[model samples]
Target chain A: MNRLNGTLLRTSLRRRSFSTADNVDGNLQGSKVQIFDRHLKRKQRDRAAWLINRKDSLVNTVADNLLDRLEDVKKTFPTTLCLGGSLEAIRRSVRGRGAIQKLIMMDSSYDMVKLCKDAEKDLASDNIETSFMVGDEEYLPIQASSVDLVISCLGLHWTNDLPGAMIQSRLALKPDGLFLAAIFGGETLKELRIACTIAHMEREGGVSPRISPLAQVRDAGNLLTRAGFTLPGVDVDEYQVRYNSALELIEHLRAMGETNALVNRIKFLKKDTALATAAVYESMFAAEDGTIPATFQVIYMTGWREHESQQKAKRRGSATVSFQDIQKEFGAGETT
Target chain B: MVRANRVVEISKTLSEILVCPLSKQPLRVCEKSNSLISDAIGVSFPIVDGIPCLVPKDGKIIEAEVSRDGDSANTKRRYHQDGTGGS
Candidate 1:
C-alpha cells in the first residue's frame, strides 16, 4: 500500500510539471498573462463595500441561471462547493431546493470569506451544513474527488491560470460530478477597451494592459475539453448596461472589484489621458440619451466528470447501417 | 461548551483534510507551533487569525517566524499576549 501511494504521488507530481511547462510557454506568448494579483485583499476590500451598498445584479443573474440549470439536473448534490464570494446569492438560490446537504464556501480573499460568514449568520439554521474557507480557485485546497458539485460565478476570469484552475476543479469532483461556471467573455467592456487603448497611445506613445483579456465564448468548450471534462457545454448571455458617462462606468468597475490589477499595469493614469479616454468613449459609444452602453458578455459553461452511467459515443465501426445505404434509400442524385 | 466543542470539531476536520500545496502530503497541525507542518517537504505554513496563510509567496515569512522564535515558545507567547487559552 505504501509503495502504491508513493507511485500515485509521483504520477501526480509528473502531471503537474507538464502543466507548469504549458503555463510558462503561455506566459511567454502573451496569450495567458499573470495580470491579476494572486493575493486579492485589495479586490476584497473594494467588493465588500460594493456588496453593502448595491446588489450585484450581474452575478445575481448568473447565479439564478445556474440554479435553473441545477434544477433541471433533478439530483440532490449532497456535497456542494461554492467558489468565490457570492455565497449569499448561491445560498438564497439553493434554499428550499433540498439539493445540498453540506455546502463549502471558499474564496481567494480572506475578507471575502469573512463577508460570506457574516452573511451566513443571519440565515443560520440546523437543516443544512455549511462552512467557509479562504482558498484560491487556481490552487483549490480541497481533496481530490470528494465534492459532488462545484459552482463559480463571475470569478474565474480573474485567474491567471484559467485552464489549470478548470483542471483543478475537475480533480476536486467525484465521477459524474458537475462543474458550472460563468465568466465575463471577450466582448466585455468593448468600448472601454478601445477608448483606453487610444488614449494611452495618443498620450504616452504606448499602451499598457488596462483591461483583463477575457476568454472568448468560442474557446470555452475547447477549454473544458482540454481540462478533461466530458460532455462540455458553453453558451453566452449578453447584457448592455447604460451609464451616464464613461466615468460612471469606470466607477462601477471599481466597485465590482474588477479594476485593473495587472502586474504590468501603469501605476497611474495621466490626468490628461483619463480625460481623453472619457471623451473618446462618449464620442464613439454614447446614445441619444447621453448614456454610453457597456457590453457585458457572460459565458456560461457546464461540464461533467466522465462516468460509466453517462452517455458515450458509439464505436467507430459498430454502426449497423452504412451512410451509403441511407443515401441510396433517399434516391440521392448529383446536380449542379 | 457546545460552541467550544464545535470549534474543536471544525479544527480537527480541517487538520485532517488539509495537505501541503507543494508536496500534496498530509499536513500535521501542531497546536504547539500554531502552524501546519508538511513532513515530506520540511515546510511549515503559519495560521493567521485562524485562517491558514498557505500561499507560496508567504512561505518565507513563515520560515522566518518559525526560526526567530521556536514553535512552542512563539505559540505560548502569542497565547499569553492575546490572553486566549491555547487551542
Candidate 2:
C-alpha cells in the first residue's frame, strides 16, 4: 500500500476497472512515483526475483518463436518496441550480434521504467542500444512513424484502452513495420475468475472480481486490421502452472510487481462478510496438487505497415514498379 | 529468517501508529501471522521483511473459525450489544 507522510494531497489514486492512465491523482503522483522508485529495495528485489523464476518457465517455451521472427522484424524496422518489458528479460533471449538496432521499453508503471533503465547493466555490449519511456500503451510519447517493430509480452491485457493502444501501436510504426505481441487470453484465468465469482456470490452478497480479461489472438488480429496494420497474423498457446496455494499465487504476482491499479476498486466489504468469502475462495480454488492452476495464453501477432509503394501503384493505375526492384534498391543497407 | 526478524521489529513499532490508507482505521499487528489487520477492511496486510504490502490483492480476509450456525447467536449479540464486533 502506498502511504504519504508529508506530501501535498491534492488528489487521490483513482480506481478504474481498466487502466491507470487517467486515474493517477495529480497530488499523489509524487508519492506513487516514490513508492515505485523503492522497488529495488531488498524486500522488493527478492520478491521480483522469485516471481521472474515462475514467469520464466512459461517464457522459455516460446523463446524460439520470439527469436525465429527476428529476421522478419529486422527486414521491416530497425527500432523495436517492447511494451512493458519486464526487467528486459526478452533481450537476453534474442542471441545474435546487433540483431536489433534500438530497443524501446515502454511501461506506464514507474517501477518498471526504472527497472528497464537499471537493466542496462545486464545488457550485452553487442546488444542494440536501449532506451526507456514511461507511458500507457494507449498513449505512447514517441513520434508517429518512428518505430519499426512493436513487441509486447503478457502486458497488453492490463491496458484499459486496448483498442486505442493497438491503434496507437499501428500509428507509431512506419508503413511496412511489424507488430508482434503476447498476452494472457480469455481462457487464461477462467477457472480462477469462475471460482472467485462463485465463492463471492455464495459467501457474501457480492465481492469484487479483479481478474483481467484478455482477448484471443484472432480477435487481436481483427483489432490489428482495424488499426490499419496490413497482413496481420495471429496465433495462440497456453501455459499451465501449478502454485502451492492461493497465498503463493498472490506472492508470485506481487513479486512480479503485478497488482490491481484499476480505477473502479470497491471500497468496503459487505457488512461482516469478508472472512466467510475468503473461506469459500480457499475451499473451491485450492487444488489437490496443493497448487492453484494458472493458465496463460500467449498470443503472437505480426503485421506490416501498409507499404507506400503499394498505395502509389494503386493511384498510378500501372504495375510498373516491382517489389523485387524496390528490394534490390532498399535492401542494400536501408536506413530505418 | 533474518528478514522475518526485521519485519517483526518494524511491526512492533508500527502496530499502533499505522492507519489504513483507505478507511483511516487503526491497525493492529496480527499475532499469528504478524500481519497488520484493519478492523474496517476485514483483511490482514502481510508484513514481509520490513515492508507491509497493504495492497488488497496481498491481503487475506479474515475468516471466522466459527460456523454460521454457531456464529448467529453470539455474533448477533456481540454486534448489536457492543460497538466492537470482536474484530
Candidate 3:
C-alpha cells in the first residue's frame, strides 16, 4: 500500500483480465458491478492505437507535462520503466542526459506497445537497450526491488483495482526508487458528467452513471503512503478545452478513446436522449459564446521507495521559537 | 533492435529484471523458441516481434520440458512453490 509520505507515483496501470479464467458475461446478479471492462478497454485502445501513435494534442500535452517532473531530480535512474503515451515523446523528454541507461516500455494493449516500439526502434543498441512488453499494471512483470524508476501517464483511471496496481508498482521498485504518474482526478470532465446526467434524467425519467469515476486528489497522497511509499507529493492540474458544441465534445471523446468503459453501462442512448443531452449541455453549461467547456483535472503523484539513506521529518517540539514568539516577531496585536 | 540481422531475442538487461507474474520466479530466455521460460513455474511466455507477452492468460505450460530435464541428474528441482520436487 502507498503510504502518505513519498514523492513520485507512476499512473496508467491497466488491470487486464490476463488470468486465463473467464467469468460468464452479464453475470452481475451476485457479484459487484465492475466499473470498467478490461477486455473492452484493450479493444478500445487497440482501435485508438493509430491516433495515440500520431500524438493527439491532449495526450501530447499531458505526457510532456508528466515527463517534466524528471528534470527536477539530479540522480540517474539506470533502469527506467514507462507505460502509456508514445515512446518518441519519452525519448525526447529524457534526451541527452544519463538519467536512464536501460529504458523499458510496457502497456496492456499489444497494438499500443507495437505502436511505441515501431516509433523508437533506433534507441536500441549494444549499450542502451529498449525493451517493449505487453504487461498489465495490476500484475507487473518485473522482479521485486528491480527498477530504479517507474512512470505512468494518463491510463490508471481504467484500472478496476487501483490500489492493487499501485502496490504491485511499489514492489517492483528498489529502495529509494521513484514513482511518477499522472491520473485523471475527480473533477475531470465535470461539465460532461453534469450534461449527461441532466440529459438522461430528463429523457429517461432517471439518471444513470455514464461518466467514469476518477480518484480524488485528496486521497492520492494517503493512498501512495499506504502503498509503502515515503515522502509522497501530490499536485493537481486543470485544463479547459473548448469545443464548438457539446456534440463535438462527445465526438472528440470517441475519437480519443476516452468513451465510457463501464461494464454495467447502457449499451446505447436513445437518439432523442443524445440530442436532448447535447441541447442540455449547450443550454446549461456552455459559455456565453456558445462554446462547450470541458474541464480536465489531472492528479500528479510522486513517491519514493523507503530507504535508510532518505531524509526523515524532524520530531515534534523541536521548534526554536514558540508560536506566540513567532507571531510577535512577525506582527501581532500585542507584541509587548 | 539488432534483430534485423540476428535472431530476435530478449536482451540481457531485460531478462535480469523480469519474472513470472504468476509464480514470481526469474524467467530464462529461450531464444530457440522465442519465449521466456520459467522451469520452476512450468510456464513459458512467448516473445513476439521483440515484445514479451508476459500475460498469464497467454502463458503455456511446459511440464514436459521440465520433466525431461528432471530425468538428468545434474539439476535439482528448486523452484517448486511447495519447496519439494513434484512427483
Q: Could you tally the backbone clashes for each prediction?
A: 0, 8, 32
Task: Return the clash pairs for model 1, or none.
Answer: none
Query: DockQ for model 2?
Result: 0.01
Cα lDDT, model 2, residue A202: 75
lDDT of model 3 at residue A207? 72
**Higher-DockQ candidate of 1 and 2:** 1
Off by over 4 Å in 2: A1-55, A59-64, A71-76, A85-87, A267-288, A308-336, B1-87
TM-score of 3: 0.77
Candidate 1 lDDT, A1-336, residue by residue in tens: 223332543455446545765655432122333546756544643465445423667657777887778877876788888887355677767764537878777776666666666676677574667766666676676677778899998788877667778888898799999999988888899888899888888988987778866777877998899889999999899999889888888777766667776665667888999999999999989999899999999898999988999998988899999888877877577521
User: Each model's TM-score?
Assistant: 0.78, 0.57, 0.77
Q: Evaluate residue B57 in candidate 3 and report its C-alpha lDDT on the 0 to 100 scale.
A: 73
Report the poorest 10 consecutive residues by lDDT, candidate 2 chain A: A1-10
Q: What is the TM-score of chain B alone in each candidate?
A: 0.53, 0.59, 0.63
Candidate closest to the true structure, highest TM-score: 1
lDDT of 3 by residue, A152-268 (tens): 887777776676678778888988899988888888888777787787878898876688777889889877987778889999999898899887787667656677887768888
Give lDDT tens digits, candidate 3, residues B1-87.
555433445677677888987767888877667788877878889888778888777789985555554555324544454466764
TM accuracy, model 2: 0.57
